[model samples]
Target: MSKVILITGASRGFGKIWAEAFLKRGDRVVATGRNIEALQGLSDQFGDQVLPVQLDVNDRQACVEAVNRAKEHFGRIDVLINNAGYGLFGAVEETSEQEARSQMETNFFGVLWVTQAVLPIMRAQKAGHIIQVSSYLGLIAAPVLGIYNASKFAVEGLTETLALEVKAFGINVSLVEPNGYATDWSGESAFQAKPMEIYGPVKDAFQKAVSVPGFFGQPAATAEAIIKLVDAPHPPLRLLLGSFAYPSVRKVYEERLASFEEWKAVSEAAHGSN
Candidate 1:
């Protein structure tokens, strides 16, 4: 069956690749971004199968309207890729409150708003998939990406809870936790806070880390994984892409378990024996 797939931030990066992948597989695509002009090429290439929409996910009303438009145009939305988010790079204190809030507005609330808008249609249809494009930062943390980590962490929580809540309606929600990928994410898409001399070392470390050869892989493989996930009979609650994410997240869990075990005596000592 040709599914109707709507992807935010679809003008470029992983979003664009996913849109192209779905279109190639015979699915109708609703590609949206803040700049719809950038999506013209997809519309030109795919014709009637592509619907370009200008959407700013930060705006709740705009999200609703965009989903409504997609529903009106395609009759049903089978998959929604909440891929509209960016990185806010800097230390916790270095990032201003306004900058931090803006980061949350787009990365966290944006996903929530779009999901809320799409839920009703999915519920009515009794079938749908919501893919939250989170980050390994969501599971763990990075030094200079505290704000970005916080945002994706919130997404992790939101999608996890949403998965359980919407399962009854046959609506599957999954988080796509990809590590560093060759995207505009840390490049043009990222917002760097005003630098402080105190954080120079951290900034330098981040720069060095990113500059490492083969640090980031292309997005084509990631897009293919997502397509396979969508086509699966039962997709997992969380799908980690890229070679780095698997071990990175596994290490986090292993360390977390070890810490818990190490503190088990103290944790149990606080409670009275039953």
Candidate 2:
């Protein structure tokens, strides 16, 4: 029997590719995204096996309904891929509070609601995979990208806690930190701020960093990696994609390790049990 997987942000990018690839391999795909028209087109192309659900994850009720529809369509959802998110570029200080909150709603709380809605069914089944699509930014803080980085960082922590909570029930969770992938990635990045004027030269430099699009690997690579992740018996908790993520992650580790060492004596003194 072919497994059924539900992926969000499935109208484009790696999310779309993953759905298509899974369908090609005989799995049922419940693909959801904010673009109803694009998702409808995918449904038309793939027919019944690909279920394109139009959803705005920021709308809490909409997420619950999407999951219900997935349950109705597939009877059971074997995998849940929280692939929906957009990048908001700006320094933490420069970004508006409203914009930051909205981003968190879509990227973090949206995932939270959907996962909670699906937990009952997954727990009943006693086996499932939860793939949280985070970014390399999840592990590091960039000068001009702190707001975006903050949400992904929260995702990293959330996934870790949820994994521990659900492990005994046989649910597997994997965090995918892909540096960048060739897609409609940049054009779709949400831009919210007064102007780059306040940021000055660094803003221009940051724009330059994000301007080059096709340099990243094809979405196909990420799709393939996600598909493999879903099938693994004991998948790793973290999987870094592309060449860029490895060094980025290593640097984050070193920075964090140094910070920990610097505070070790302070931490030890605070430990009441010690």
Candidate 3:
């Protein structure tokens, strides 16, 4: 079934692949991103099936306006892919409050703004799907990528709750947790960092991981899964986009569960009168 799809951050990486996938399927695509040249290139390649819109999702008003524009274009929106995100890498202490806030603004708050903008329309229509492209970090945490991990964790929490909240509205929310693939998705994270003398020891390991191809995550495969999920008769609440994400998530969950059980004695003290 052909439908209208709006994909945020559609100029490159996973977003770019998603736009092409939807267009290839004869679905109308409204692709949005911060890069005008990239957006123009996408439009040129995909022709009229892809509508390129350069947008900054962090701007709540602009995000809302973008949704309205989508409504005008397709008469109604069937799928919304909130894929705009960035990787802000830094150790917890190395990252200042401002850095954390910016990460939250882009990864979590921006998604919230977009979802809020679409609620009324989807609720009225009584049929819609929302796909949020998060990260494996959303389900797990690493030593250095603290800020990025926090943002993704927030995205996970929001999407999980939202899936239940909108179930009654006939709107399905799915969280996409992608591991790593070769894309400019790394961007500045590929080089720049506020290096610390203390972290100098393990820097090589992180840098090595960054340099490996296919270590980042595969954009095309991730996009392919999203296309399938959107078309699924009954899509799951979450989809792990890369081969590594699921195992990493399972390990983290298991570890967390074990810690909870190991600390049950301390937790039991909470109810004591002492």
Candidate 4:
């Protein structure tokens, strides 16, 4: 059976890759992006299998309309991939108020709006899947990506709760956390803060970390995993893409566990018998 999948940020990056992957497999896709022109190729190639809609995920009303359009076009939405988000590269102190809010608007709130729009339809159908394209930074953190991390962290928490809440409705929620990919995410698609000399060392270290060989994985390699995830009867709540993600997240958790053990007495004392 061909499934109807709605994907945001289908103009480029993993979004476009996954959209084409689905279409090639005979799945219908409602491919959306801020620049519909960038998505025209998909429509040209896949014809009616792809619906390229112009959408700025930051707009709540537009998100609702997009969902409605998908339902009207395909009769039902079987999957939704919330891949419409950009990275904000800047240290905490270097980030401006507008930058932080804009990041949240598009990254966090955008996911929220689109998910909200589709929930009713999925609930009515009693089966659906929602995949949130988060980042490995959502599980951990980095120097210059503080705001970006926060946005993804918010999505992680939101999707986790959503999974639990919608389980009875047969709605599956998964967070796709990729460590680093050879995508335009960190290039033209990213927002950079005004550089400050005080944070030069921090920026340099961050750059060095990402510059290591094999740090970034190929974007196309993720299609198989995504297909398997969507086809699974019981999909995982969190799926980490790339070889770097699991080991990196494991190390972070181990460190966290050690710190928690170290602070066990303090943590217990703070409870005050409550």
- The candidate that wins on TM-score is 4
TM-score of 1: 0.97
lDDT of 1 by residue, 206-230 (tens): 8897787887978888777988999
- TM-scores of all predicted structures: 0.97, 0.92, 0.92, 0.99
Local accuracy of candidate 3 as per-residue lDDT tens digits, 79-129:
999988888766677877787888889889999999999989999999999
- RMSD values for the candidates in order, in angstroms, are 1.1, 2.2, 2.1, 0.8
Q: How well does candidate 2 score on lDDT at residue 74?
A: 90
Candidate numbers, best TM-score first, in rank order: 4, 1, 3, 2
What are the Cα lDDT values of the candidates?
0.93, 0.85, 0.83, 0.95
Residue 139, candidate 1: how far off, in angstroms?
Answer: 0.4
Candidate number with greatest lDDT? 4
Q: Which stretches of candidate 2 lie over 4 Å from their true place?
A: 207-215, 266-274
* Higher-lDDT candidate of 3 and 4: 4
**lDDT (C-alpha) at residue 201 in model 4:** 95
Task: Write one digit per residue (lDDT tens) for candidate 4, span 94-165.
Answer: 999999999999999999999999999999999999999999999999899999999999999999999989
